[model samples]
Target: MRLKPRQLEAFRHVMLTRGVTAASEAMNIAQPAVSRLIRDLESEVGMTLFTRQGGRLLPTPEAVLLLAEVERLYIGIDQVARAADDIRQHLNVVLRMASVTSLVRPFLHRAMMEVVGPRLDLPLVLDVENSRHIWDMVEQSHYDLGLVFGPPRQGDLQTVHLHSSTAVAAMPPDHPLAEKDVITPTDLLDCRVLTAGRNSPLRRGLDRAFSQAEQAPLNTLETSMLNCCHFAAAGMGVAIVDRITMRAADVKLCAKPFLPTIDVSYYAARPAGSRQILVLDQIVERIKELLDEDTVIAS
Candidate 1:
């Protein structure tokens, strides 16, 4: 039994759209043409792939199984298209990477430039996402590399430590604690505080510090680490953030050392692929160097 590309396309579209009419619209073809393709495909496969139900076409078990294989094929087709595009653009190499949003500007750019300088034609697809999503994206092979705060926990990833720094407290310029060179957890007593979300390593350390003081912050707002400075500048509360996030010199906010310091680790993570890209290695090396410089400056 031979299956034509149009027949498979129609079957895939109907399965995705769940109706001949919708599939026709999606594929920019007439409904009759779509139905004919599906019919031909079913005939070739010798199985009824869909059942008509109340104006909606539901996939039978065979159709569901077929669609899985079709989807895998589509993924390969997409990769081919991407490679063609890279060649068309005259890119020497293409590397897809992702990182937490906060690192996009101050961190990722610097690292990338350090490695790929003067080669602007080299294509780099960078996905900016939250730290929580970085691991899953890398593990799924959605991104070739990921730069993120904290250690890599997933078993599928090969991770390297890039930097380590202590947490710092950020407050509005005029906040009472701003006058202090180093503000400890107790110094924030009776004050509203902003911190990383509950699952964050930084938040865990902040919680421990407050617990040691036997005091709960008067109020707490949990948010992205990058937003901590924004919250502090807005006078929402004092924010606890990593040294990387705090290293920015902001006139609107004052950063001070946190007592009972919490250590934050940054890692360069990649899926354990059979082939490693040399560019990815260079990027990680640049990141390590930059972070080391930042540490020396802070000290």
Candidate 2:
């Protein structure tokens, strides 16, 4: 009835990478050894975890359920490792935060430094991920806090609004649309626009704007809001997303107002179990102050 750590590890990697050979490489073991581990795990669970289909290992229904549980188990294991790190360093608490890329540098990092400044040895793990991933990390209690796109969908997360801004039309400095003070969907009729993917909340808002103009986005590229600027700067298309992405992009891009604006907001979300309340409060306040002063957020 007991499942071994190596067995679970092999099963999880197989489910994630989708092949025994790939899983073996990831676990730094031989391919046949991976097959044997999977077989032993299947025996322990008494279920067929995978079926071969077109040279791919496809998870069965039971395997899918096991994968979810296995993932949670791994998350717990990761938390334990972090705890061990904290103890090894003889720290009372460590700050683990995840954030969207747009929220860093001139914004979140400055605020974080002001709070944790004096403690040079203080362990801080700041992970930069997409907002969707940040949301999940905070909700799962993997991180103490997360700065992400607003309107927290998870009921358990306590959040405070940090900033709000309108989406903009971003393009290369010399793009035709850059000539307009305010770019609308009609202005982009002949252009290939870049926009958030269909699954994104930003996409829904952008779709409404296009609908109001009675125009299709003409956007052939569906990407992350962050990538909109990068893709547009390459002259692939015009970007319509939060201004921060355009300003945050490594390459230069021009951001202009978008007619029929799409508003976007970011918030600080955290679970109730955080011990760094004073530091969190200070960081939140500092971010709000920076948001007010940072012209990049004034879009």
Candidate 3:
């Protein structure tokens, strides 16, 4: 009794779609052919994998257990294929990277492209979200590496600091504060400010800075996207954002160092007991080198 690779693929697809008709359509095969494959597979294994009810395929208990094992097997197969491709092309291994939304474009994406070179045979699948979600995914081993704006304060994770940069204030070119070499919390007392949402690290830092400075808080327009804040800034609102974000915007905005500069350090992180730490370390080191190169070129 041998279950072939094609049978396994059919079973996995049926389980995923939970409908033989849809699975058959996806596989570009006739429904009867899919049904025959599943039947043959069950006969060989001596177990009923699915039960049909209300025209839907429902997995049996045995099928659920088998599905988990099958998923792992497929993942291993994928890794093998990817590894072979990398070797054939003389490329670094493919890495799955996740990062907070704000850092994805200007920081993580650029740094990786610079360090990994323009011809990337090694692919990176990037997931961008808020820091909390990124941390959650990393802890669950959903990503090979994670880039975060600040150190993890609550998670049991391993981290390597990539680099630190100062926060800056952005405003439209014609805005009053745009002419300043630098701006302080006191200077923004009555201004309308655009910022990332309250949960963001940048927002948290700005709140603390304002509290310490004892300045009245400005009216804040909160959004989760750094780009949106930049857009608002270009529309005549003052925005306090990381320098990396400000520099990437295409709007007519001026960026100035924020007084008592809010410094941010980005870190690469993975779960504490991860076996893939070596790969993540390589990525972090490469990013740091890229940042150094950028600094040298700019200077």
- Candidate of highest TM-score: 1
Per-residue lDDT tens digits for candidate 1, residues 1-299, read 78898888899999887789988998899999998899888999999998988978889999999999999988999999997886665455667888876566566788877778888777778887776788788788778888887856858688989888788888877888888989776777777788888877788888888888865666888888778888788888888987677654243777788889899898988887635677788889887888888788868
Candidate 2 achieves a global lDDT of: 0.82
> In model 2, where do residues sit more than 4 Å from their true spots?
1-92, 273-276, 296-299
Give all candidate RMSDs, comma-separated: 14.6, 19.3, 14.2
Model 1 is weakest, by summed lDDT over 10 consecutive residues, at 243-252
Which residue pairs collide in model 1, if any?
none
Model 2 per-residue lDDT tens digits across residues 1-299: 99999999999999888889889999999999999999999999899999999988899999999989999998999999988886665366667888887788667878877877888766678899877888888878988888887656758677888878888888889997788889888888888888887756677888888877876655468877778888888998988888666555667888888878788888898876654466667888898788877755453
TM-score attained by model 3:
0.60
The lDDT of each candidate is 0.81, 0.82, 0.75
Each model's backbone clash number: 0, 0, 0
How far is 249's C-alpha from truth in model 3 (Å)?
2.8
For candidate 2, report its TM-score: 0.64
- Give the alpha carbon lDDT tens digit for every residue of 162-280 in model 3: 77787778887787777888899888877877777777777788888888897745677787546655565557477888655654454566777887777777777887786643444
Residue 26 alpha-carbon offset, candidate 1, angstroms: 50
The per-residue C-alpha lDDT of model 2 at residue 124 equals: 77
Candidate 1 deviation (Cα RMSD): 14.6
Worst 10 residues of 3 by lDDT: 274-283
